[model samples]
Target chain A: MELAKMEALIVDDHPGMRTAMRLTLSNLGVTHSQFAQSANEAIRRIKGQHYDIIVCDYNLGPEQDGQQLLELLRHNNLIDLSMIFIMVTAERAYEKVVSAAELGPDDYLIKPFTAEVFRVRLERVLQKKSAMAPLFPVLQAGDAAKASELCNVLAASHPAYMIDFLRIKAELLMGMGQAEAAQQVFEGIVSERAVPWAKLGLARTLRLQQKDVEAESILEGVISESPEYLAAFDTLASVKDKLGKAGEAQEVLSKAVAISPNTLARQRMMGDVAMRNGDITAAEAAYTTIVEKGRTSFFRDPNDYVNLSRALLECGKNEDAINRLREGRQSFSNAPEAVFAASVMESQAYSQMGKAAAAKEALGRAMALKDSVPMTDELKLDLATACYRSGDEAMGARLMDQVVRNRHEDARLLQRVRKIYTDLGRELEGEQLVQSSTQAVVNLNNQGVLLAKQGNLAGAVELLTEAAAQLPNNQQIVLNAAHAVLTLVNREGWNQDLMLKAKRYLEEVRGSNATHPKLVQLQTLFNDVQNKYGSRV
Target chain B: MSGQDEALLPAMLAASLHEVKNMLGELTLSLDALQQQCPQQAAQIEEMRFVTRQVSDRMVQVLLLYKNDAGVLRPNIEAIPPADLLEEMLMEARSLAGDRLVVSLEGEQAPPYAYFDRYLCEMALMNAIHNALRFAHSRIVIGVGRLGNALCFSVEDDGPGYVPAVLQRAIEPGGHSRDGGTGLGLYFADRVARLHCNNAGECGRVQLDNAGVLGGARFQLILP
Candidate 1:
């Protein structure tokens, strides 16, 4: 890749910037190049022929941006790996930059650059692309194995791109749950660089091996080095809570929330921790903030209001609690979860206020709708607690068993289940029930994995599918079934009976992990094979 | 081209109507390089280049006003070091003066950081300097200083004084006090000053007043 031979495309809405960039390219002896003013025009040009370079202004026209255009193009596979993309932005935004980097652009250039600065950027990108040219054709043709091998070679030869290539390679490795191999690369990178992403990768690998303590340390290292990395703080805090270091976890979350006060999940986690610590004031604040701020965000949760009402009821604010629950329902008019949770709160409020008839009405409504409950582990826990408090101890114990079974690998959730049982006056049985349910879930998951590996794919799929019904929202159970069925279908032919079972299992897995690479990849191959062949026996 | 479209364009293209008083800048730099090679013709060529750059500056000011009226103007705001910025402006004024105007950087060099889009600030300064050069009799003095709270940067000429109507227009409710609001040099200057005020941050103000060793119009920009 001689500089002069490389074809470059410059896209900008402003004629001045476009002219400036053209002059820059000409200065580097690239006399021939293409130009486009809008995203649509750029896409049209790209479709006609591949260019070695693209210099796109971050703001195209008023309608779309460079990153959005890139996403749309890559999503459709209209552009190949060898076409180097450079996004030119004024750097006015923070989120857009991160998203572009994560989605993978060749590089970025801040606006108003001099000729020298522009040349420095172009040369850097061209050098890297040329170095990785050996693998480009295979990657372009969708050969993942050749792409991986090429990436390995580039990682060894090009020390500059080693970090980036290794991280991408490790993501593919971990997707297949080759945890030991992924950890080796992650550990190698972290040993020299102390990079936040690599450290987090190592933590994720350790999490697979159930090493919470070491994973917690890696997360903490990320926090110390880069306090603004929100994901690290979140993972570290969750690991702390899961390790029963509730107070420590709360402190970590408090710092994280101070920096970025916007996620519904984090606020809900805070509320739950506050409730555990008997900090009703803090719990109300956390829940109220989430309810108020999460109105426009995708992370909005109805649990915030339900928890708030519960906290108010515990404090003897019956009127306030009643209004709180009503407000929650009014805000989320059509959500069944909100409707059900609010009804539960209304029942508790009325029962406490000595309004027996209203209490009975609310309780009956909850019971009627409980049969059609969405069956999330969270909802199950809430219902089980409600039943136990209302004196149906047997049913409550059974429901609690289900929550415990779903979260068998989660020691801290088991503790909460134990506490909930003790609160309802089944002290002796609560301990026994939590242990029994946890063991059952672990046993079933292990047995299913063993069966799948032994080529008893039919039996493994059956076993995991039945378990998914019991623990519908559990990641491990749903994924086990999806993976088992996908493996069976991918290795052997897709039997019609097995394809239906696999589709059901995959539907559950997709909801929780759309980008979990293995599941996403398997789902694609499985669906294609299922549609094309009918080799049912 | 269509008959109607052809009818719209000027038949004999002349210089832009805004003002040929500025942009001696682009010419001077180009001519200065040429003069080094041809010293025998350098003196007269240098003079022509200086005058040409001055014309270009005025042209840009008027062109900016034209575009402002057409509503096609886009301003870019970026942070610049006020001290280095002031120093550079002084150097440009000094070069244009060629011993006639003595511009000195005063007080602290611009602080390490000040926020205003660089090109916009440069245009505003260029206008005030060109305006001062035209009005100054023999010597023009451009001063950089801080007044109380904000960075009060001024361009002053040791000329007789500002024309009365122009002075009044600087303070008047609108910038359209000239014969035809089209010359718009003062108007665009005022607007650029205003546009650079707080672009998404603090509110800054641009103003014209009389306060100088030379009893002339002073252009002041206060950025928060």
Candidate 2:
């Protein structure tokens, strides 16, 4: 933790800032320092070498700001908790910039700060980092229980970081699916002081426990008190969405976007919620911003273009949708999924424009490419829509049934399915299909759970594993299989084949949604079993 | 200007000021390097750095005032150790004062952690420290203490006390002394202080007194 021993990277577009930062770092005895003129160069340097610290300017020549860079680093797992990252901003309204980020830097320094101030902030962060060093290994190993235990010890020893330790403990509990315990910790913090973060944490915990009413009230209070807190807005929108108020969620997201408009995830969420609310104009605007701003950034996704096209088609701008799909097809020329999505959307646009021949041609192209790439539920829904529009009811029904079977628990997708069916005047048939598919999955899951309860772990594992194989994208069934496998291993002896099966099941769920609540618990259980049996698998 | 252009005027000005402030920050570091390389002219370099910091601080004040006008200047209050804040101000003051003045902490120990905005309070206290460094005959004392239910940070200097006119203006609402400088620092300090309020709805304020612990001027920023 010595300043002289720390290797640092300074990221700034201005040569003057680089020179100034270098001089300042040297003044603080930080001799081993590197400089990068932009975020891309900084990322490149970070990939090549390890740096103990990174001091990056908030404005990095318009390509990517420091916050976006931090997000990229975090999302890609390029940076870990061991290193320190500090953001430097000249704007006094820096809260907007920092709060908009999903993963903020370790600390931020306001611009025009002297070397003395910089040293103080750096030293403070270093102290906190060292205090947290003991828990990192366990945390990285996915041992949430052990990490929570260490948090208590660290809070006692490092009283200055007690709240920080408690916050981590709360998040760990949430990750382990112990919503009640997380709620207690958050409540303890909020009772002493209604800190905005603590309130937000409590609201999230409440939502996890299905207490949406309480969560909604707390989030409303948080947003009113701290209007610039963008995270609160996001959480509030989610809670509202869970309460079936997509229109209200869109309004809340609009306010947050007005305050700070550059967050890609927020923009995407805006596009989604607006689309759900049938505000096609707002959806088009949000998707347009995403497609424009994300063109050259890591946040760019081919789905953004598809989404934009969908909005345009909804707005009766078929030619514009077709033009956008053509451009998107070229931009993502080598990605099969992108090509497939563009083709499907193109067919939809053509069908909407009353060009049956063109639509039929596009549909043929899409069907040929469909099997070449994995289909997301959204893309499958689009293909189904295209099929129905092109007078292929049987093909559309088959696709819809597959989607419903795989994502039976997804209310939003189910709603979209219903809309598609209603638009085609097949509401009764669609309802029956949805009910039968959902009931089938529910019966299978229930039977497995029942077998496990009857002390027939082998029977439970066999049933759930087969169900999971049949519906690979079904997170609930996959998680149940993994849980049964781990529970059997824990109760009986560890079986190598069963352990690998459990690992694969967990990995499948993680590949689709890493932050799934059941994932961390199952992963921790798997790790514990592995450690106990002393097996590499 | 068009209506749209007029609406963007504050943001444009704020951006320009931020750019200027960054340049001033660079100039300050250059002065620090120059002082190190040419120790004989360290005092002169330090003085130039002092002026550069003053401009930078003024830019921040203007930007903050604009935010206040736009009703967005909310303080991000946090629990910060009082000693750390005082120590930071002491270091900056000593660097600016160099060998000309004795800048020191007033108390043996700092108070417990207090809830306030560290950056805003630092800006206010540093402005007072800079004022003290300008007029102090020999020394400046920075300290933190409790005032009733509020936390108080004071900058006391062994300099000529504030003039009666300035002291009177300090007590007046929206008052600025037209004595020597633009009085923006005091106005900004007052605005920053008022932005901090406790759950009990008690707002913070600035108090100026001629009777100082250093037998001169004493400026106190009291926050609830």
Candidate 3:
């Protein structure tokens, strides 16, 4: 709680900043501070030690900026709530600063600041962290209900921390799947003051309640008033996509990318949306930026290159497409999925160029590599298309069947399968295959749910878990399996092996759709039961 | 110039300014360490620190001017408590003045909150406080209060008030003092004040007047 007792890390590529910060900390009687000259070094230092405070410059030379580094830490669950993160940036870099707001740093200090100002800002951050000290330990220990209660009491009594406590309370409720309670808190905060973040939170709560039209309008107002709010753009685009307005989502993502092109996630989103909407030029441009800008960071996904090549091939740039696929394979040589996708793309490009021998060779390599990597619905779709185009209709149909059996409820994928069959002039056969596969999976899911509803928790869990293992790519089935496990544990008491199985399914679902409502529900239920009954393992 | 080249010009200027500021900061730190070792030369060291701060402040003003000229200067507004704002300025003054002058904040009747760009407002206020500390006979006071609907924060000194010509030039746009003062600080403070606008279409403004609570020169920034 005291400045002298705190351990601090200063991250800046500039020696002057490092020296200046050391001097300032020395003035405050702090002696155990460390300095890092780059983001990579900062990450290494942080991983090896615990720092109470981090003073990071916004720009850290040519690699990942402070925001991207923070994103990586948060995505990997590396940062705990107790540590204070202060982003130091220069004046006139308002766009980046605004964008960083969503990353949830403790505070930001504009550059060209004096030691006195630094002390003030640091003290403020410390005071706020002290106020939040009691809640984080409870929440991190997986006690959401107790944490929510503590926040309610704190917000009711502490006027200074009322706003902050309310904001935390809302987020906790949202994480606990109590959307109505979170919506109430967000609405109260918005009515008291027209803060853009509070309004955006309210929109998210509305979305969770399936009031998407109202959420869209609220997001529109927030975005129009605060054009620099990148998170609002992302949420609005999702709302548009859910409403079946793919064009609007693409436009929203376009605006966000224009404002802050350095963010790789937004570029990927723009590329995906463009490809889905059949805008080959836009898809190619977005993926091009993603591959080029993400090359230096851990965010570089081989899929961006593969997708770009596909867009190019569609646009009739066969030579450029082939080059892209080759470069992609070189960039992500260790990732089997990336290599497989690249090989598939290569076959597609070669076949489009009328090089049948080359296409056949590429297809052979892809089929050999496919068994070594975990199969996802998206990858299977790509491989199936490539197989069909290479004159292997039987193998293509088998792969399509695998995709359908894995996700019978995915109407969009079913449509794609229909189009593929129509292209092969076997529409009737394709329809029969789709109907039978979807019916079989649907019957298994219904029976499991029925077993759970009839109080046969063990039977339901066994059936669904086995089914999910058979059809690993089925998100709905995995989610249901987790739910069944959670209910069984809640009623029948703790079982360590079953708990691990549930956690695995929840994690798998999160990997594919992190924001899915069903995944959130299952996650909350699983954590609640585990926290209530201590883990035996 | 093409659009890309034009944009690069400002970026290069900002980067160069940043490098120079860092060097100045390092020099200030070394001087501070030097003063601790050689207490007899503390006055001389303080004078050097003052000069360094002046240079840094001028560079900041030039960068701000360029940003405004390029139409890229937009305030990031935040709500700051009055006490915290005043305390922050006093800290900077203490670092600059050392033991040569006293600096304090007076906000007994000020409002609880003020909405403005904290970074810009602090720079403007620090410049005024630094100027006052130099001219003050022995003490400077930063006064915070409400003037009608606008919030006013002023820096006042106990030394002789600003002369008639200096006071006249201070308020006028593009006017410099005849006594070798560039008056960039005053111009910058004025511009920062005018950049803040309230929902009622009221823009912030600056006032320079003699005979304050300290019976000396006063620089006040009033924001709506």
Candidate 4:
């Protein structure tokens, strides 16, 4: 952590600015420095080597700016809390840049700052990083419980960073699904001072506890007072969406996008909200922006292409939709899931254009490729739409039943299913399908839980394991199976086969939804069981 | 102006100012490089750098004022140690003053941390230091202390203080003194100060007086 021993990456497109930073770093005893002329180059260098300090210019040519680069680095786990990332901005209106960033840099230095100021800010961040260094490993290991406990210890030890530690503790609590505990922490901070971030955190905790009305009011005040706080706008939009005000949510997102249009996730969210509101024009615009911006970004996903194509088809632009899918096919040719999605959307577009023969061909291709990849709910719904449109009603119904059963708890997806069924004049049948599928899953889950409570761990394990096998994509069932197996192992002994089965189930659920609320608890339970009986197993 | 034009004008100005600030930033960096390469002429180079930064600061002031007029200027507040902030100001002030004037903190002690927007407060205080650098005959003292429940940061110089007209303008809130100077720095300081409000609903303010520890102009940005 000594300045002389630290490796530094100075990212600025302008050679003069880079040289300035290099000279500045050398003066500060940071001799081991590397330079990157653009965000892409910086990313490449960062991927190759570890740096103690990264000084990135805000405007790195035309591609990803410093804020976006920070986001990408954090999102991809290329950087951690230990590294110092300082954003250098020429714009004095840096609030816009700061607020737009979902993951902000450790600190920001305005352009033309003296070497003295730079050193101070760098040392300040380094002090903070060193202070919280102990918690980073625990957090990286996904031990939220230990991390939250460490936050309290660190808070008591590092008085200067008490607020920061509390903030992290609250966020960790929220992530671990302890909403009430997180709310208390946020309330403590809010009572002390109405910091915008703390207020936003409080609103989030409230929303987590289903107090959307209170959350919405706080968000409105935060947004009104700090309009540049883009996170507030995003939270408000979600709160509105949860309250069943899709149109209002779309409007809020539109305002947020207008303020800061470079965020890909926000644009994707706007597209989704607009789609839900049945505003095809707005959806198309948002998705188009995502497609264009996502081309060179690491945050790009295959869903961007599929969503764009879906938006185009919804707008009756069949040729455009086909062209988009073709483009997606070219870009993601090696990705089976992407190819499957493209083929499915292509079939829908062709069927809408009355190309029955071509539609059938695309549907056949999609069905063949579907088994090659794990089917997501979105892709399943799209494929089901294609099947229904191609006059394969039975296939469509089957896909719908699987989707409903797998994602029985997702109200939004259920709404989409209902909408699709209603559009096809099969509302009654759709209701029946949803009710039966939901009831079946509930009964299976309840039976396992009841059996386990009644000292029937063996029965619970067998029942839930079979249920998981039948609904391989069902996160709840897989997690339930993992929980049951872990509990059985914990109570009795570690049976090798059951332990392996539980591990596989946990892995499957994690692969689908890594941030599932129950994931950390189940993972901890699994680890505990392994530690307890690994020698015998 | 049409309503559309009225809305577009500030954005256009902001964009142009942004471009100019960027160019000035490049120029300042080049000046820093020149100063380091030619240490003998560091004073001249530092002067150029100071002017470049002053221009950049002025541009930012105008941009912030425009944002305020457009109702978008919200300060990002945080808990910053006052002593650390003043230490940074001292370093920058010493660099700008070079071998000409002795710039120092008022006391050897550190002040407690306070809640304010570091960037805005830095800009405002640096503006005060720059003015003091221009007018101070021998010394400039920057200090932080408490004014009632508010945190007060003062920049005092050993020279003649502000004139009557400027003092008059300071007392009158929202007074636009279109006279000798545009008074944009003081206006920006006022705006930034007012942006910070305490839990008691007391807004921050700027205080100007001839009573200085250095017997010169004393400018204090008092933030609640």
Chain A TM-scores of all predicted models: 0.63, 0.89, 0.89, 0.88
Residue pairs in candidate 3 whose N, alpha carbon or C atoms collide under 3 angstroms:
none
Candidate 4 TM-score over all chains jointly = 0.87
Estimate, for each residue in B161-180, the C-alpha lDDT of model 1 and write its tens digit: 65566665443224443233
Name the regions of candidate 1 deviating beyond 4 angstroms.
A1-150, A153-162, A310-320, A371-373, A388-398, A408-410, A426-465, A473-537, B1-224
TM-scores, all candidates, are 0.50, 0.87, 0.81, 0.87
* Model 4 steric clash pairs: none
Query: Can you tell me which runs of candidate 2 are displaced by over 4 Å?
Result: A1-7, A23-35, A44-49, A99-103, A113-117, A353-361, A388-394, A449-455, A479-537, B1-45, B106-112, B145-150, B159-170, B173-184, B208-215
| Highest DockQ model number | 4
User: What is the C-alpha lDDT profile of model 3 across B1-224, one tens digit per residue?
Assistant: 99999889889998999788878877877887898999998889889988998898778878887776777676666455666778777777877777778888788877655667776888889888877877899889897889997889999998787778876554543576423477778888888998788756688998888868788889899998
lDDT, candidate 4, B1-224, per-residue tens: 89999888877887898889889877876876787799999777877888888898998888887777778777777766677788788888987898899998873443445688888899899989889998899999999888777788999998888877777755433453323456788889988999999767889999988898788899999987
Sorting all predicted structures by DockQ, with the top scorer first, yields 4, 2, 3, 1
Tens-digit per-residue lDDT, A431-485, candidate 3: 9889988888889899999999898989999999999998887888888888898
Best by TM-score: 4
Comparison by DockQ, 1 against 4, better one: 4
Residue-wise C-alpha lDDT for candidate 2, range B96-201, written one tens digit per residue: 8878899888644444466778888988998898889877999999998887878889999898888888877544334554337777888888889998887667
Tens-digit lDDT string for candidate 2 (A166-235): 9999988876557778899999887655778888999988876678899999999998888888889999
Count of clashes, each model: 19, 0, 0, 0
lDDT of 1 by residue, A124-211 (tens): 6676677678877765564454466677988778754666577767765664445667799889876643455667888987775667
Classified by CAPRI criteria, candidate 3 counts as: incorrect
| Residue ranges of candidate 4 with Cα displaced over 4 Å | A388-394, A422-429, A469-537, B1-55, B106-112, B135-137, B160-169, B172-182, B210-215
Instruction: Give the worst 10-residue stretch by lDDT in candidate 4 chain B.
Output: B171-180
